[model samples]
Target chain A: MQSLIPLMRSISGAVVLVLALSGNSVAEAPLGLGRAVEQTEIDAWDIDVRPDGKGLPAGQGTVAHGEQVYAQYCLSCHGEAGKGGINDQLVGRIPFDAFPFGSDPGKTKTVGNYWPYATTLFDYIRRAMPYSSPGVLSNEEVYSVTAYLLYLNRIVSQDTIIDADTLPTVRMPARDRFVIDDRTRTESFLRQ
Target chain B: MKNSVSRRIVVQRLVGLGGAAAAVPLIGAETKQSSAADHSMPEATARYLGSYPSELGGRSPHVELKRRPLADYASVTPLQDLSGTITPSDLHFERHHARIPDIDDSQHELLIHGMVERPLKFSVADLKRFPSVTRICFIECSGNLFTSATEHTTPQMLCGLTSQSEWTGVPLRTLFTEAGVKPKASWFLAEGGDAALMTRSIPLEKAMDDAFVAYAQNGEPVRPEQGFPCRLLLPGWEGNTNIKWLRRLELSDQPFMTREETSKYTDPLKNGTARQFSVVMDARSVITAPTYPARLERGWHEIQGLAWSGRGRIVRVDVSTNGGRRWHEATLQGPVLPKAHTRFTFPWKWDGRGAELMSRAVDETGYRQPTRKQLIKARGHGSVPYHLNPILAWIVQRDGQVLYRAEQWL
Candidate 1:
């Protein structure tokens, strides 16, 4: 029983050592510390160009290149003019309140009216586009299609060069409208 | 039990069971007719044979009941179609934020760091080496029934995003011991390795309670879609809390407050306040078979449904014949598990009277499932679109057709 003291102390000492080592490793690791995002890494993943122009990639594509890209990749479903016939409408003056299908009775929410960020357009298209084959387009192809879509939405001119520097500055009308959801407290009370 | 049955028979005679007995005969005829008519829809053809005509292996037949594919998610096991509580692993509902990552078991590692005595990286084999524990529990997505708020939604659109499976893994305490979690750590972040890199902050108390790092579902290695190699299993909580493709667990004193928790899973109420970290699923039940797109024959039919609660076991499930006018207790199947879907049945005979059929779940906490009107009154009718599990109503037509009765929150 007398030897139990050293054994107990030794066990605790080992535990303390393990704890200290783990603490040091965790503090040293930069797993998800929200560091100052690098420009190169930001450019790679920052495909989302919000309405006010943020996180847009570098490089530019002309309307002609965009037109060719659209026909090759998008025209199959989005229609030749990209006005949307069989699929959801991508072009035309969007009246946010009007319903095109009338079958749903729900208001027709289009990209021009509801999409709060221009960055989302690039991001979404880069990630999942063409419906038939998503994530297949190259970065340049994504840029061209994005330009063409924006031109179709009537938000930008046909010759407007969209790159990383100018993409984040493109002001979207819905930018200020979409408020971050504040529904936490009410949901709790209702559940309670 | 036999004595009680005899007493019930005697009581039935003393109460002049003539009227009630007559009602039973009428309902019986209605059931037989409906069964004869509902054979029109291709019930047998609806069985999903796993994969999209592409066999990546690891598929089973007993697990293919209520399966529907969406953008990045899928529906659950049709509890109404199932006989018992055990959900075959493959048919388990999937709710993934990003594409399933193909993780090589050899390279996969679980890094446990932060406020721990021994921050350690455990390989897949290492996790299996720990004192393993197997448990039966249900994991459900918080947004499981986002579309089920109205009558227009099908069961697939309703609360079909939850599935129960026998999870085999190491108890979290084992990993905690290996990593040596510090006393000061109150919260920990579970991060995934998908493109979205989903992360959620979990309380240390939950980690100490029933938390586990599961590597196998049912009797085999975890399915790729259900987070192959390894994932965190928070039994009874919403699905998102159980981080899939689990790669990192960082113990901390504060919440990480990831975008998925703040922006996506949070529920927006009528008061314009969006609720965050609302992980527990309330008690709910839905009749799957005789539901939308299924026409009935109007005869003796078994009213089958599933009832579950995140808090605990579903103590009772009440079925209403004439809409919400009157209610009768349904018979629950044996081995009713807490936090698992419990199958219930009520043998009913319908008389071809155009009526509305619905079921309400009552949990051990005595919280009864609320109707659309009641839910709207509490949450307010607006454009909020997540965690909506209002009582679902199905309209029975005289022509033996059953359609989902869509309701609006006005």
Candidate 2:
């Protein structure tokens, strides 16, 4: 009890000293300590749903609902019917040619033909979708939209359900096309 | 009397907060330094600024040069902390697949052999002997927009690959005349000696225009991260085109269709096709200061930002007070170099008005900076994200709070 009193007194004195120093500036503290992050505060910004379906939430939606969601949230930028707007086309068919260069004419490659994993679509959309409000969609909504985009790209049937289980299994046409970068001979020749 | 008591409590809290904030650097130092040995002046590096630590060769002394997510995969430039258009070469962000290799300039030679009338080899010295031209230009990476995401990506992603320099080098034309490039050769392969063995094929016409075999940046020899000894400087083109540590130039009838050109750099679009060979960076502008995570005071402040275009020079950069509703031309910092980042500034009288602000770049080519919407409209929403040079806006509240504005790209 005797030691406790001295410790408390010292802590209070330290706090008072700090209070005196910080009082000189107005543009110092923001949101106040009360509004400052609480120890138990959940970090909403750390949301990153991986392509392997790590952070996906559980919910259910149909292609019909996805069409509506796509129109409401995604269509303005991505375009209606997934044809594409000012942003990238989320849905498409047909594999890229041997000479798929810039997004020039006669070199159209899309999700159905190029992306190796269907889960990549779900992960990318959930994390960075609608362009304006990313990470704002529900899991079921994300699944439904993924299903709808797959259907539009001719990768999935219209009635197919897309969930964590089935997303990895959904085969993409250009899955095996990508290879790791190789610069061995190129570098050796340059050294000479 | 009760109000005064509450006010005193608030003042007490404020004082406590200020002291805590001030002590953050000290606490950070204790946490940031891993060892006691690190505390002493590295003994050898006292002549240099900051701790180059030998672990990371290129680092700035200023605390502001530090980027978030300090990792090997990529590093962001401290755009908000920088002042002039010319980014201190040391502060420039570096993203390489492998470690930088040291090349002996004495032994270094550029071989121009394939598809030419006369296969020629020019040593670093021989290449410099030709008529050399020095010009300031900006080199930006194709994937510079990764940081412009809604969740405030770091400056590394925003415009890390982009850098301005008064590169001194011999023009490709001068070299072409010596090598006697065949007319049938439409494209040329530029190969690098780095571990990634980076390679890219560029059109001969573009090469003949303004490309050069650069050997210097700013006033010094180029850094290893920048492809020292020799590097190709393709002004206004994607940074990848400016191959560092360049060694070979092989002329060909067609592009080698390297993996980088075919699979990596290409942008997939709505029509199920990809856009390739699109090298020129579109006009873009960003307010470096007062960006995310930076606070400001309410007063007369100078709005500063960087503007650039791949097609040509930045003629004017207009600032928007009420978002994009009202626009006024900002004064561009002098000696605006072509194909380089032109520093633009505007004096603003902030009455603590809660408003959204943005700047739009206008290039000499007369192509006005596009909004996210305009870019989407032209490129298609299905298009892959690359070369997205939209005007970035920052929302400011009366309390001097600034946040990246997630505007409508469409």
TM-score of chain A of each: 0.61, 0.66
DockQ for model 1 equals 0.05
Q: For model 2, what TM-score is found for chain B?
A: 0.83
Q: Which docking class does model 1 fall in?
A: incorrect
Please report the TM-score between candidate 2 and the true structure: 0.61
* Model 1 segments more than 4 A misplaced: A1-192, B1-66, B72-80, B146-154
Per-residue lDDT over B180-293 for candidate 1, one digit per residue giving the tens place of the 0 to 100 score: 789999988787766655677788888888899999999899988888899999877788889998877878776554445543465445443445566777888888767766
- Go through the candidates in order and give each one's DockQ: 0.05, 0.02
Query: Which candidate should be chosen as best, given DockQ against the real structure?
Result: 1
Candidate 1 TM-score, C-alpha based? 0.61
